[model samples]
Target: MNVETETMKNEAAPEIRIGGGVPVLGPRDTPVAEVVHACHSASIDQGLAALAIPGLNRETLEPVLQYCAGLRCVADNVSCPGCKRRTEAQGIETLDQFILSKKEVIVGDGRVRLKGEGTETVTTPCLETLSKQWSGENYWFWARRVIRKLRHGLRRAHMRGEPVAGEGETPSIILMEPQLADNIGMVARACANFGLDDLRLVSPRDGWPNEKARIAASGANYIIDDARAYGTLEESIADLNWVGATTARQRDLRKPVLTPEQAIVEMRKRISRGERCGVLFGRERNGLETSEVAVADAFIMIPVNSRFASLNLAQAVLLTGYEWMRSDAGRSLGRVTTYEKPLTEGLYLGRDRPATKEELLGLFEHLERELETNGFFNPAHRRSTVSQNLRTLLTRLNATEQEVRTLRGIVATLSQGKGRARKREE
Candidate 1:
């Protein structure tokens, strides 16, 4: 006699667990019924291999290939010899004969086996309701939802462990008063894309534990599940040792301003020294206010067209994350080296160390003194501008220690010539 078991609501659809693991039904949007029909449409003798009881179904068209792999083919019939012997030993008839006589069969567990028997139970777990749907209102919508849920479930079951962020010195992303759950989820996905995991939120407009965010996150639940929410911005970033505020507009603050590339270098430097760092992202509409910017130690500005500098919150986070990964990834960005032997390797490679600020400042003072004595600054009011111009010119060189000393020697020789001319005139 066939035994039937009641399936609980919101429970897993009946599935043949393969190798003690969840069965992979198929790829995303793979029709489950089609796979079942394909497996049973033709006889095994006609080059049709029956699917195994428990296995992944990547595509509904393929069904479960591993299922048929286990069955032994004998006399135009695909059957499990062991399973047939077990059931027959248990005083039951052949599995195929039993399936032909019964519509539903109950296994040892409470799970309802919709099809097959013995070692091969081809059953749909949580999709029992789909067996009744023929045609009606909102059928496709419900079908799509069910399919999506199944796809996610299959993916979850196949994974041996929860997905984690990549290993690196990724900075924490802090969202201040974020408005949309969609944006938050997108940001989490972007963070995952770049190996970033630490996500901190301050006063989200719709509050926390948002379902929409989880749905939007796709498969990056690790970030959403472990994301921290705080009441105020201060509380959110209180533990961070260094914070960089991302802003598009130029501010009058005295804090150091750096492009994304430069900011990542500094961030990496600090992280290497055992300091925790984070980036502050403002709301969607208006960016961080003056007070909020003041809390940050530095500013990170992405060089974009000034006319339209507005960037989506997720985009900004993605760009920053990309730069962070690129910083230490040893990725070459169009760096060129000479393939041929150089004529003058000494001059080019002699500069081993950069010139110290003090050395550069001393050179600047020495040159400025000689210039002042020679009346180079004719217009008294323009002295400051002239001095600034000279400093700017030197700053552009990024002179090395050797280069500074050489330049100082040149300046000293020129001063000596002027001194001799003045002495002769006297």
Candidate 2:
């Protein structure tokens, strides 16, 4: 089996040389979706050029190539053959591992250079930019999700009648330079889970209209479809009446630090007065920068352990969204479907009423008669005390009418005989 697989991998390379030497990524007659899938799968197992997909050209493959390259390098860092070979040889899968394996060269302008083997050098973005972009994402997993989207349409695409928030009803969730499309999708899901409708992205890392984001959204396709991406943070929040930037690190800025609950309250007040409100979340790698935070009217801080205050992008959005919907009058404890009614806090007694006092008395009398017949109260002197104790225990049950009937039936069956026992006695 191993030999056959190796032969197939070797044979797959030559099939790319067809139709005037244009590289095809899959076999002839392959569906476009299958070709895309093969391209991504081959990009992981082999290189991007491994597959020979028919009808796949540079123009058609540009998006996949860009996505693959973005996943391999950090923040527009150039991919080098030497670095690729070294990473493949050493089985280095993570960005941190790739960074550590190479020698860092600090240039005169404070820019970092990654020196790979044999004169191959790659220039990287600033440390802060690198930190913001490199999220330790699984490239292959992302590829599979993209492939899934190509094969099947967005999740819950057929479902309809999702509640839409009205104007000023909820705050717009603004994500500033989120690195992972998956994180953005999860943030959309979080937004949908609450009542927040508007989603704005400022300089998303992988670019907008990403299938990965749609796939990551699970069933919240509406949010993903409606999400707007902007080139700058200013452009993203220009229409908002007020904006709060969420962060864990304390900034020296004099802006008010409001908790998530307090921020939601302020937003609700502003929105009630016909003002648009928004919440700004920073990148997944590092939270918002000081300059970015300065743009917001206030700082929204969630209470957490001081030592470990950093949260995932979706988590921060989810927490803020929860607070926004916490006091909603129309909100149910959980989902309310056609068959399932909304529930409140208390014991649920479905289709059953509490036992009446007369029913309780009848049960007590029946149980006492059974006990007396079975000689359960052995000592005649203490019969009254034992009977009182039994009555107290039975009264405390607070059983329903159905429960009382079940108890009586149990007592009768045990005192007499049931099924096989009755047959044996006969």
Candidate 3:
């Protein structure tokens, strides 16, 4: 059963409220109803009644725990629907009904009806509802402690609960002779971060299922739990058809030294040829030996500074994996946000076509009239050159028909001042 349900079994009244905001220790046999009445009469927070119990044991007063423990399908402040129904059936009301009793309450999105009284339907309990009810500092302090203790459990409800592996032609990440379990865990985390799940460890130093490694991995338990340990690098990548060793050094070996992008493209080409591929990342302290690099088909080099060309085990894995995903044609590059119709047509802008030669000439004539009237052309001989230059500039802009019309409208507005004045004088 839950903590709240376990605490309800203990039959005891909370502290009795004396006059002047003082609390008198009630007997162990005091009823919950009397305790609630005293809290209401003394203007005390009803949830604070649990504080009256000596030593403040949560196990004994779990029913009155207002803030949510943040477990799966559970929340704070708002009463559980199951608990509410049970208590309502027992003829008990008001207690544990702090948020639900309100006729209407405001949440994050908008307003919500607490009861089935209005046209709007009663909304489900969410973060907004929980945050609204328990506004006490003391309550929040306890709530934070509870949340920290059960932080991992909070995501249990939303988790898919499946090992992420073998979606398509994903390259496996093989770590050769890793020293630290924390590094292994971090590598696993990086693999998970980039959707590369196949983690093969070649004889980790601290052994498999290391607690420190799991702790370092945080919530990436899937990669850690499914991590396979092999005796050697050869055994680790034996199932793979091709292998790429990631190193920062420039060696004298005859093997092709390819950048991360080139390595990923080669791996993809090999994958398309119905061959499995894996990238070998050496230990954290010293990277793969020259002999070990010889086994790989290519050397995957990250273009870093030549002076300090070293990367952490997880960093190398992450970079290579990112490049692999980048080169993979299956994955979408970014969020797709294309409209069904053409932008100009959907926006209802008149003249979706480009400006024709006739329309362009008409706009040029209209603008030339204004420029001539305003004495923009200082000399008549330079007028043709100036007009040709203007036409060339306008042509370079590739302004649409709508844009040409807009320029014409602007020219008409600026040049109509004298005509308006003459008409007024007439």
In TM-score terms, candidate 2 sits at 0.68
Better of 1 and 2 by lDDT: 2
Q: For candidate 2, lDDT tens digit of each residue in 1-426?
A: 697545544552212222321222354533223334444433322323444443344334545544443443333332223233235545676666656655553333655465543333344456665553333334434455544444554567665335467856789999999998889889988998897889999999888877667657778888887889999999999889999999999899999999999998898889889999999999887788999999999999999999899999999999998988886767777787999988776767788999999999999898888898888888878889988998899889888999998998787779887774355435
What overall lDDT, based on C-alpha atoms, would model 2 receive against the true structure?
Answer: 0.71
Candidate 1: deviation at residue 12, Å? 22
lDDT (Cα, tens digit) per residue for candidate 1, span 12-127: 33343222222224223222333333332222211123443222323332223323332212222322222332234345444455444345554435364545434553333333
Model 3, residue 214: distance off in Å is: 7.8
Write the residue-wise lDDT of candidate 3 on 1-426 in tens digits.
987745654545343333322222344543333333333222232334543554233343333322222321122112232233223433444423544444554444565434522232334456543554332222323443333323333222243234444543778888888988778868877887677878888888767756556655656777777788898888987889888888887778888888989988887788788889988999887898998998998888898978888998888888887886666545554332563332321334444778899999999998898899999998888999999999999888777898998887777767776577345335
RMSD (Cα, Å) for all candidates, in order, is: 20.8, 9.4, 19.2
Best by lDDT: 2
Please provide the root mean square deviation of candidate 3 (C-alpha atoms, Å): 19.2
TM-scores for all candidates? 0.43, 0.68, 0.49
In model 2, which range of ten residues has the least summed lDDT?
14-23
What do the candidate models score in CA lDDT, each in turn? 0.65, 0.71, 0.63
In order of TM-score, best first, we have: 2, 3, 1
